[model samples]
Target chain A: MTDAASLSAPEAARRSLVGWLLVLSLPLLMAVMELSVYAVEPRVLSLRNIVNVLDQASYAFVFASAQMMVILTRGFDLSLGTSVSTVSVASALAMTGLVAAGAPDALVVAAGLIAGLGVGALVGLFNGGFVAGLGINPFVVTLGSLNICLGLSTTISGGGPVFNVPDVFSRLFYNGKLMPGVSIPIMIAVLIGLGLYFLLNHTTFGRSLYIIGNNPRAARVAGLPSRRYLMFAYLACSLLAAFGGLMLTARTGSGEPNLGGSLMLESIAAAVIGGVSLQGGVGGVGAVVFGALFVTMLSNSMDLLEVGGYVQQILLGCVIIIAIFLDRLRQTRA
Target chain B: MTHIVDRRGAGAVSQRALRGYARVGFLPTVLIVLVVAMALFVPRFLSVQNVFNVLRSSSYLVILSAGQMLVLIVGGFDLSVGAVVPLASVVSAMTMVWAGGAVPGQTGLIIALGVLAGLGSGLLVGLLNGLCVAFLKVSAFIVTLGSMSIATGMALLLTNGIPVYGMPKAFVSGFGRGLWFQLPTAVYLAALVVAAVWFIQNFTKMGRYLYAIGGNLHAATVSGVRTKTYLVLAYAVCSILAAVTGLALTAEIGSGQAVINGQLTLESIAAAVIAGVSLKGGVGRVEMVTLAALFLLILTNAMDLLRIDPRIQTIFLGLIVVLAVAIEEMGKRRTPVD
Candidate 1:
C-alpha cells in the first residue's frame, strides 16, 4: 500500500530511511498543526469547511502536479499560468458549441478533456523541442513561452474571460456530490492524484524520467531517449496545467483569462515546500499532492482566523523560506 | 599546400568573428538598422525630443540590466530583481507618504532613506542567495526562485496588497522633476551607474575572478581563487543595482506597483543573455548588455509605432530568443566549448 515496495533497491538505498521519514513526517506534522488549529476553531472541522478546502485546493492540486513533473525532470515551467489561461479559453470555446449542438454529456466531457490535453501537448512540444534541440536552458525557454502563452491567451480571449461553459461538464466538476454530502471536486483531485502516482511510479517511462533527471547524459547512455523523455515531461506538465484550468473554469462556471495567475508561484512553492527538489530526479506524486493541500489548508486556516492578506502573505513567505531551509538540509543529508 | 591551408585558416578566423558578431550582435545590428531605417522612412525617428523620449524610457532598464549583467557574467541569475526593486520601492514610498505629513524637508530625507533601503534590501537578499549557493551548496536556480517568492510576499505584506502613493512633493518631486541640460537627473544617474559598471568589469581583479569562475568553477577553485566570496559580491552588486533600478522606477512612475515583476524579470534576463553574455558565464561586456537593452527598447518602441498587439510582440520576442539560442548553439558547435 505504501508504494515503497515497488521502488528498486538502488533507488531506495540511495535514499535513507530518514529521507523517507522526512517526506512522510512533514505532511503528518502539518496535519497535526491543522488539527490543533481545528481544536481552537471547531468550525474548521465542519464538513462544509472540508468541502470548501478540497474544492479550492483542487485547482492547486492540478497545477502543482504539473509543476512537479517539470521539477522532477530537473526543470521548471514558468509558462504554466499562461498555458492554463490558453487551454481554458480554448476548451470553453470548444464546450460552448458542443453543448449548443446538444451533444451527449459524456461526449462533451471528452471533447473538453481532449481540447485541454491537446493544447497542453502542443505547448509542451514547442518548449521541449527548443530545450532539447537547441540546448536552451529550461528557465529561458519557459520564460519566453510564458509570455507567448499569455499573449496568445489574451489575444484569443480578447482580454476577457471565456464564459458559457457547457452545463454537463460543469456539473461533473462543481455540482456533482460524493458520499452523501462531500463535493465532487475532491473526487477529481483523488483521481488526478492516483493517475499521477501510477504514471510516476508504475511505469518504465517514469523510471526513465527519474534516471534522466538525475543525469541526462547517463540516461542517454543507458539507451533512454533523453530528449523525448524531456519532451514528455513538458507535455505532461502542460496537460496537467490545462486540466487545472478546465477544472477552475468548471468550478467557477466560467473561464477567466487570469484564473490561475497566482497559482504559478503557489504551485512551485507547494512542490518545493512539499519536498520536491528543484534539482530534479527526486519527489513523488503523493508529496506534490500533500504540498498543494498543505498550502490550501494554511490559506483556509488563515482565512478562518481572520488574518489579513498582508499578514497572510508574510506568513506564507516565512513558510517558504523554512521549507527551503529544510529542503537544503535534507539534500545535504542525502 | 601549406600556403593554401594558412589562407583557409585565416579566412575561417575572420568568418568566425563575423558570425560571432551576428549571433552576439544580432539585436544591436537589428536595432541600428531599424533606427536608421526609421529615421529615413519616418520623419519623427531622429528628432532630439524623440531620442530623449527613448532615453528616458530606457533609463531604468539600463540600471536593471546592469544589475542583471553582473550575475549573468558570473554564471548565476537573480530572478528576484523584479520583486526586490518593487518591494523596496513600495516600502520606501509608503514611508515617504507617511512622513510627508509629519515634518518639513521630509522628502529629501526620505529619498536618502529610500536609497539606503534599496541598497540594504539588495545586499541582504544577495547575501542570502550567495550563502544558499555557497554554504548550502544548493543550486542558484532554486535559491533565486525561492527568493522571488519571498520578496514578492514581502512586498505584498508591506502594503496589505494595496498601492501606496500620495507622498509629499519634496521627496519624489526633486528627483522626478530635476533636470539637467533638458534631460532628467535620473538619466544622468543611470549613465553614471553604467559607466561605473563598465569600469569595474574591465579593470577590477574581482571582475577577472568572475570570469574565471564562470569559465570553469573547478579550475577557479583549484587555482586558489575564493569564488564563493566573489559570487557573494556579484550577487550583492546585482541586488544593489536592482534596488537602484527600483528607486528610479518609483521616481519615474511616482508610485509603487506590485504587478510589475511578472514578466519584467525575464525581460532583463533576456536582454542580458541576448547581449552575448555566455550562459556559461565569463564572456561578456557591459557595453554589449547596454546595447542589447537599447536594442530591445527600440524593437518594442517600433512595435508600438507599428500598432502591433502587445501579445504578438511577445510572440516575436519568444521567436527571437529561441533563434538566438539556436544561433549560439550552432556557433559553439562550430567553435567547440573548450
Candidate 2:
C-alpha cells in the first residue's frame, strides 16, 4: 500500500530545492548575459555594478515583497502603488515644508523616513479596518483604497510632482558604499530581504497568513485569529510599501504623483513570476526576491539591447504568462 | 378585526415581495435620480448634446458589462474582457489601416472584419478561461488573471505599443458621428444590445441553467445539466459581448488605444455589482446592469461638471461600488452548508 505521509517530507524538500534553484537561475543567467553583452566595459560586471542593480531593485523588492503577502492570502493590494506614491509625496512635503523648514539635511532625511512610516501605518489601518473589520471583499476594498490613496497624493502635490529636495538626503542613500564596492542601497536590500525571510519562515503570524489563505474557515475553526493575522499582514505590506516609497524619494530627490503608475501591476507580475501564487499560501520571500530580480534584469537587458520600449512590455507580459503557466502546471503535477 | 388582520398579513407578504423586487430594481431608480439630479444641478449636464455624448461614451462599457454579467450570473468571472477590448480595437484598427483595404463603399465588409476580429479574440480568450476553469479544475480567478496579462501582452506585441489608426472612416466615423432620431447611433446600438441581453437572461433556458449552476454547482451537476458545457457557453457569450463593446469603443474613439487604464475593469465590475449581481453568483438582471451603467455615467458626468478632481471622482466611484456590494451581501441570508 502507498503511504501518503511517507512521501510528504521528501516531496516538500524536493519542492523547496526546486523552488530555490528556479529562483536563482534567472538572475545568475542574467548576470552572465550582462557581463558578456557589455564585455567592452568588463568593469560593468564589477561589484559596483552589482550595487547599482541592487539599488535599482531595492524599491521594487520591498514593494513586491509586501504585495506577496496579499497574494499569499489569495488577495492583492493594487492600492499599494498608490500607497507608496502617497507616502513619498507626504514625506517630501514634510521634509521640504514643515520638518526641515530649511533645517540640516540629516534632519530632513530623518523626517522623511518617519513621515513615510506614519503614512504607511495609517493607510494600513484604513485598509485593515475595512477589509478585516467590515468583511468587504479584498479586491473591492483595495481598489477603493487605490483611488483614495491616489487622491491623497494629488491633494498633497496639487496633482504634480514635488521636486527639489535637499541633495544630502539623496547622498545618504544614493551615495556611500556599504563595503569597498557594494552600495548602501544594496546593503539595505540584503538586510530587508533577510528580515522578510525570517519573518515569513520563522514566525507564527507568517504561517497563519498561509493558513488563512488556503482555508480561512479552517483556520478560524482551528481557533486561529485569522482576522488579526490578516490585519497584521496588511500592516506589514503597507509598512514595506512605505519604505519603498521613501527609497524612491531618496533615489529621485523628488516625489511624483504618477511615479507609481506602472508599479502596481509590475510588482504583481514579479510576484507571480517568482512563484508567488495569486491564490495565495504557496510562495516564499526567496521566490518573490528572485522574481523581482528577474523582471528588473529583463527590463534592463531590453533597454541595453535598445529594444523598442513597447516590445519590452509585450515581452514582459509573455514572461508573466509563461511563469504563471509553469506555476499552474507544477501545482497540478505535485 | 380578524379580516383586517388577514388583510394586513397579506399586505406584509406583498410588501416583502416588493422589497425583494426593489433590491434588484434599486439601481435603475438611482440612475434616474442621478440623471434628474444632474439635470437640476448642472446646466449642461442635461442638455441634449451632452446626453448624446454621455450615451455614446457609455456604450462600450454598457455592452462590456452586459457580457460580463452573463459570466457572473453563471458563477464565473472574466478578467480578460478588458484585455480583449483593447486587443480587438488594435486588430480592427490595424486591419483597416495596415493589412487590407475594405473595398470602397463596402462598409459592411470593414464592419464585419472589425466585428470578426473582436469576436474571435474574445471567443478564444473566453474558451481558454472556460477550459482552464472547467476541465483542468483551475481556479477561475487565476485562469482569467493569467489570460488578462496574456491578452494584453498580445495586443502590445501586435501593435508594437503604437496606436493604430487610418481606418476607413465610413465604417467607424459615420455611425460614430451620426445620430438616429436625434441620438447617437452608438446609443441605439447599446440599447439594442441591452435589450437582447435582457431577453436572454430573463427568457432563455440557458439563463436558468446558469442561475442553477451558480446557486449550487454540485446540485446542477447531479441534475445532469452538462454544467461544464453550459459554463463554457456562458463565457463564450460574455466574450462575444465584450468584443462588440471593443469595436464600439474603437468606433467611438476612432482608433485603437492599447492602454486599458484599469478604469474599464473597475467600472464594468462596479456596474454589474451595483445592479445587484452577487459576486457569489446566481443573482442579478440585465436591465439592472444597464441602469447601473447609466447611473455611473450620470455620476461621472456630475463629478466632471462639479469640477471635482479626477482622483476624487475615481475614489467616489470605487466607494459607491464597495458600498453597493456590501449592502447586497448584507441583505443576503447565508445558505446552510451540507
Candidate 3:
C-alpha cells in the first residue's frame, strides 16, 4: 500500500509533482481567465459578486458531483435533469393542493419535499430496473426514462410552470442567508460535496463502484453484487439531481416541467471539464469541485463580457470537446 | 393465450421462420394487430387523409431513423443528428431567404444550390463527429453529444431565436406542399432515401463492412476492414441524412426555427430497436425499420383520433420504447438457454 516504499525519493516526488501539475493547471488557467475578465469589469471581481457567482453554480455542482459518481461506475444517467424537473413539478403540484386545502404550511412544505425525493427514487427504480436487471444499455435506457419523466411532469403540471410556492420554502433553500456570510444554497452544496467525498473514499460501496467500473466481470467473479451497486449509483445520481431541482424550485419560486432540459448537457460538461474520466473510476473529489467551479466561472466571465447566451453555449461545447481531447492525449501519454 | 402451433417438430425452414418469428416477425405482427384494433374502434383511423397524415409524418421520421440506423449498425450512436436537423432547417431557410424571390428560370439553380449548402454544412458536422469518433479515439457517445451541443448552439446563434421568414414561394410549395399521385413530395424523397439505404446496405462493400466492425471492432480491425474510414462514413451519412430531413421539415413549416425536435433521436432509436436493430450493432434491415416507423406513426395517429392527451401519449411512447428494449433483452437471454 506504500507506493514510495520501493521507489527512490526523487522518483516518487516527480510522480506526485506530475499528478499535481495535471490537476492544478486547468483550474489555474481558468482562474487567470476569470481574473482577466475581472480586470475588464472591476465590479465582477468584488467579493460579493464572486460569492453570488458561486451560489449560482452551487446547484450545478450538486448535479455534477452526482453525475461524476454515475460516470465512475461506467454508467451514464441522462434522466437526472428530467428527474429533477419531474420531482420539482410533482412537489410543487402537491404543495399547491395541500395549500389549497388549508393544510399547515409546515406540513405542506414537508410533503412537497418528500414528494420531490419520491419522484427521484421512482425514476431511479425505473432506470435501474432495466439497466441493471435487464442488462439494457444505460445510455438508451436513461434516454427513454428522461422522456418518460418529462412526459409525466408535463402531464401533472399541464405543461405549465407551477407557481405560488410558500415563501418559507424559498427562504430556507433558495437565496436565503444561512449566516452573515454564508448562503444557504452554497452551504447545502458544500455539505453534499463533503458527503459525496466521504462516501466515495471511505465506504466499501464506493470502492465497489471503482472496481466494477474498471473491470465489471472481474468484480462479478469476486462476489460483488454488481447489479445492486450499479442500481444504487443511479439512485444516488437521480436523488442528488432531484435535490438540486428542489433548490431550483425555491430559487425560481415556481416549478417548471422542462427546467431540466439543459441540465443533461451542463452537468456532463461540468464533470468532463473538471477532469473526470468518462472511461470511469479516474476522477477525484477535489478535481470535481475545481471542475464545477471552473465551468461555472467560465460562464460567469462570459456573462461579464456580455457574451450572448447562445454564444456561451457554443463556447461550452468547445470546452467539452477540448477537455475530452486533453483527456485522450493524457491517456496516450501515460 | 392458446399455443396453437406445435413448435417442437417444426422443420428447418419453418423453424427458421419460427426463430425469425420470435425475433422480427413478432413486432410486425403486434403492429398489425394494433392497427386493426384501432381501425375497428377509432373512426377515421383508416381514412385517406389520416393515412396520408401518418405517411407524411413518417416520411421524415423514417428518413431520420435511417440515418440513426446507419450509425447504430456500425456500433456508434450519433446524437448529433438531433441537432443537425435544426441546423439544416435554419440554414436552408436562411439560404432561401437570401436567394430572395425565385425567378422562373433561376428557381431550379437556386434550389439545387440550397441543397448543396445544406448537404455541405452537414458534411462538416459529420466530419467533426466522424473524425473524433474514428481517429481521436473518443467515445462515440461523448463526441456526438459534444457535437450536439455545438450544433444546437449554432442553430440558435444563426437565428437569435427568431424564425427566418420570406422563403421563396416556389421553394416551399415544391418541396413541402407539392404532391404526386396523391402523395406528398416528401414521401418520394423519403422513398428515394430508403431505397438508397437498402441498396447501400445490401449491394455495397462498405455497408457490409459496417456489420463486420459492429460485430467486433478489434477483430474487424485486425482483419483489416479500415474501421476508421467506415466509422467516419457511418457518422457522415447519419449526420447528412438528418440535415436532409431538417431541410425538408423547414420547407414544410415555411420558415426555419431554432428549436429541435426533442424526440427525434429517441424515436429513431426506438424504431430501430423495435424493428430488431440491435443496439449492440451489426444486425438489422431497412425494410423492417421502415415498417417500424410507419407503425409508430400509425399508433400516434390512432391515439390522436382516440383523444389521448399529448402529454400522456408521450409517457406511453417512452414506456413502449423501454418495453421493446426489455423484451429484446429477454429474448437475448432465452437464446442462450436454448
The backbone clash count of each candidate, in order, is: 0, 0, 0
Q: Could you estimate the TM-score for every candidate?
A: 0.89, 0.87, 0.93
User: Which residue pairs in candidate 2 collide?
Assistant: none
Ranking by lDDT: 3, 1, 2
Ranking by TM-score: 3, 1, 2
Instruction: Give the higher-TM-score candidate: 2 or 3.
Output: 3
The superposed Cα distance between candidate 2 and the true structure at residue A9, in angstroms, equals: 3.3
What is candidate 2's lDDT per residue for A188-294, written digit by digit as tens?
Answer: 77888898888877899887888888788889999998888888888888998888887788888888777788788778877877778766677887777878877
Residue lDDT tens for model 2, B86-194: 8878877776664346365666776677667767887888888887777766556656766777778788878777888877777666766777687888788888998
Error of 1 at A17 (Å): 9.6
C-alpha lDDT (0 to 100) for residue A144 of candidate 1: 78
What TM-score does candidate 3 get on C-alpha atoms?
A: 0.93
Worst 10 residues of 2 chain B by lDDT: B329-338
When 1 and 2 are scored with TM-score, the better candidate is: 1
Off by over 4 Å in 1: A1-25, A97-110, A178-182, B1-13, B16-23, B97-103, B106-110, B160-174, B256-261, B278-283, B336-338
Question: Chain B alone: TM-score in each candidate?
Answer: 0.88, 0.90, 0.92
Model 3, position B58, has a per-residue lDDT of 96
lDDT of 3 by residue, B1-338 (tens): 12325445556557566676775656778788998898888768888888788889999989999989988998888878888898888888777666656543577666776767777778889999999988888877778888887888999999998998877677789768777888988899899999999999999998899999989999999998999999999999988999999888887888887886777887888788778787778988888899989888988887799899988888787787788767877776775344
- List model 1 lDDT by residue over B21-85, tens digit each: 75455566677788988878766767777777778767777788888888877888777888888
Give me the TM-scores for chain A across all models, comma-separated: 0.88, 0.87, 0.93
